[model samples]
Target: MSLGKGNFQFFGGSKTLYELKQNMATIGQQLQKTEGELSQKAIDPTASMEDIQAAQKSRDDLKMRFDLIKEQHDQMEAEQKAKFAAKDNIQNIADPNEQVMKAKAELIKATIRQQPIPADVKQILGDRNNTGGEKLLPTTMSDQLLMEPLVKNPLRDISTFTNLMNLEVPKIAFQLDDDDFIADTETAKEMEVTGDVVKFGRNKFKVFAPVSETVLRGTNVNLVQSVERALESGLAAKEKKVAFTKSPKSDEEHMSFYQTGSTAIKVVEGANIYEAIVNALADLHEDYRENARIVMNYADYTKVVSFLNNGNSTYFAAPPETVWGKTVKFIDAATDPIVGDFSYSHFNYDLDVLFERDKNVRTGIEDFVLTAYVDHQIKLKSAFRIAKVIDTP
Candidate 1:
């Protein structure tokens, strides 16, 4: 099967895909070993015919299994391409509103079966052009995908999001040393401002949602909503993971808060978690402290609660809505408590998501692939601070 940039074909779910690939590799190795054994047995002067036949059969069976897997993988790719082509036909619709719902329903039905794009739908989308069959999601659909993640992730509420189309964005920072009133006619002094450019579009991410045949084939199911919900959940989780964790590879561009070389504030000696958080807030620059909010894992919040309640099991207090006079956000991806004005952290992505479909013939499951180009930058490092607590004996 041919794989292109942003277009990957895999059989079954991600884990199953890995296992399938490993199985193929093992079978190929065994086939090669059997071939060597067969050659040796065939040439042996004292070897029996039965021994030679057994060796040959072993090699043949291994080869057959390997070939069968390859065939299935190729078939799945072909089916995906066909479905994509059918989906593209829906773009011809002139009215944007009509196109959105019509295309959604047609695509969902096409995913369940290999039927052709409806004649009316095809006519509405118009003829295919010379764009190599690549198309962006409609405006309404794009908005839905963009807003859906906010519902799934609390981090989205605190951070700034921009639909950036350019490769680089220039950030200007100005510091005015004098704002005092002077004589009305007095000349104002010019102040020097600093500016820097941050490049974007360096990070690429993909999210996949696999649907079982049973769910897709259900007559009473709202297929469109079902597929959308799965995609939304997958995208939300992947985005949060990327935003909070550092990339394993040093060479790759990572917008994670835990980027290497980032400065972290240590918890003061003899301070509790709540006090540590308060100290972290005090450490932030005064200009950013007013807008600062706190983010940490829920588990860490539970530890704070335990400390507050003196570890009493019967007298549990409800989780605090605010910590240190700032809104507290919980994300499982957060490893340490971060106190900062997250508005300075910008997350940017293309307004469109490329959608593709693939089916695992053996398992009767289909995976919806959503590919997006995204990049993020913390415009001002000093605007945020991470708290690290150290235990002492």
Candidate 2:
């Protein structure tokens, strides 16, 4: 969540976390709305004092229930931050081997977090109640620039917190041996094709069936006490509690994704993170990618860089944050040598910079991004945690 400084300063590391907080605001609003509705019902005009008090008691109980759940969500968020911080801290060791260790740790955490998506969950997620939990981009561009995706599935956001609900996200089962060891049901069921093809001289038609059971692969299951050991597994083990204070981006101005602006960084879906990062660096280095069609500020993108660090491959930019005249992306490799660098992502700028920048806090070029241009954002993710029950299963 913290950018230590320098190159890390320009990296999306910090901006991403801020946007996450932005997404959290919506959840908070929902909570407050629920509170207001409850209060209205409790203080109904014709209610007796006894009835009002009873309703008030019910409200209090509801508040506690939300608070309890909120606490858990807060804990999960804190743990996520801690895990990120730890990975970054380790990466800062300045040792290539240590850096690998940390990246490996991060990768493991990502994999472990993914472990919760049990096959059966595909069924649970399809439930009607659960469908509301997902959001989609506006039917149209929703605004001037094409800054939205066709889907609003929160789980796909690369910068958002790992979804903890319904993914079968692992939880503590209990501790044993006086906390010397811990237990969890963090197991996964993966289907694989293993039967022999039995192609005998191109003769005979044969049928094959996949086994329903799983072969035990190591789970991230670990004892709850060791931080270093936990990192060795594919899941984040760091746990903590966090209190989120409301955060709003600055009134820096605005630009839509693919609109004329000085700071907008158009992004397409399926863009590779690594590739986007390099391109952003290169774009800044080369100054601007091209002259803007509506606004003429793209000329300022003229800052040219000699090369990407560690190689002669100077990062390049594709004009208007575009490539081959298309706005959507399917891969990092598709970017022009110079065009793939800009990113308005979690690691970069966020939505409030466009919608509510008048109040949100910002750092780096994002100050320019909100004030200068509209970005073409093709990916969307929310920053909150909640569960949607289906059929009371």
Candidate 3:
């Protein structure tokens, strides 16, 4: 009833596989022992008919159990082999970008379906397990989403990002010295350069987008891309509000340029928006003016365009992309024009976005909550100058 013992190998080397192999071996041994007992009973004339029938039944049951165990072991081995083969094929792709794209697509599919991401896909994307059932976007996808706002989020484009991953206490260090070099003799005393560090405060931002369960479960819809775009728009709007309109109190951490208490230069009497911007730029320190970017509302930019194109000319020309060789960033939510070196504005963010689903069983409506950690500060308040246009009474 038992097959001969042969060499056996299993993929993945998992504990479950090892235990299955042991169970198979133990069942095979029991079947062999039962067969031997049944044969002896059949040959012995002293053995009763009832005893012989019981031995045969015992042998048949053992054989059935062994067959079931063998079937399970074979199935597990085949699954592991197929997984490894697919991984090998992915690794053998010539183009690295193609490999990443393929892996990213797999991750996206898994995320949309609310299934666990494959182990190989996680390895390729350097992703961690979703222990809390919150799906984490792949690193590549997170980076793409973060940068996507740059098209409409001028603040994000101009601000500098500091990687704070694995940091217990994130901080930004800034040099306080005005001059690092001085004209001195070889034996002149060396001056000490000073600097300061600002500890980052924890700030969390969440964006929620309502998605239909049908869309999430459907194969025809591109749920990942759609959710990504929706989240991107939502985040962009929140960023504009945070960076331009939020006025933090003294006890609160300053997260917006408007809250930094930087020097505000009021527009001179009878000056146009363009002149006001120029005046604001002039007010900034010479050291910061070189890298200064002009940030204003889109409506204000239209006014500047009108001012520039007011005169009748032979050729129709659009406003230059830059003002006085400085890049101009137009945001819709800005109330005042700002001229400053935005590099001094520091932002820190988590490398991955956590996605969670909120389902309403009563209404059959589902929404996804996308969460990310972020902190922002203006390292040097003096590096910025705001143009405050006072109303004429």
Give each model a TM-score.
Answer: 0.61, 0.18, 0.62
What is the C-alpha lDDT profile of model 1 across 1-393, one tens digit per residue? 223323333323343444666767877898899999999998998999999988888887777777866666566667778888776655655667656556666755664465544545444434242353554443444557765443477778888776656656544244245554322111112111222466666456666667676756654235556677777787677668767776644433356777765222223322656767777888765767889988888888877777776756532444455435788998988887888888877777776556667776787778766677767676656677777675766
- Show model 3 residue runs off by greater than 4 Å: 1-114, 129-137, 147-152, 166-195, 217-221, 246-253, 260-270, 308-310, 313-316, 360-365
Q: Determine the backbone clash count of candidate 1.
A: 5
Per-residue C-alpha lDDT of model 2 across residues 268-385, encoded as one tens digit per residue: 2213333333334333322122311111112222222222223443345434333222222222211122232122121111121111111113421111011112211212111111
RMSD of 3: 10.0
Better of 2 and 3 by lDDT: 3
Q: Rank the candidates by TM-score, best first.
A: 3, 1, 2
**Top model number, lDDT:** 3
Evaluate model 1: give its TM-score: 0.61
lDDT of 2 at 223: 14
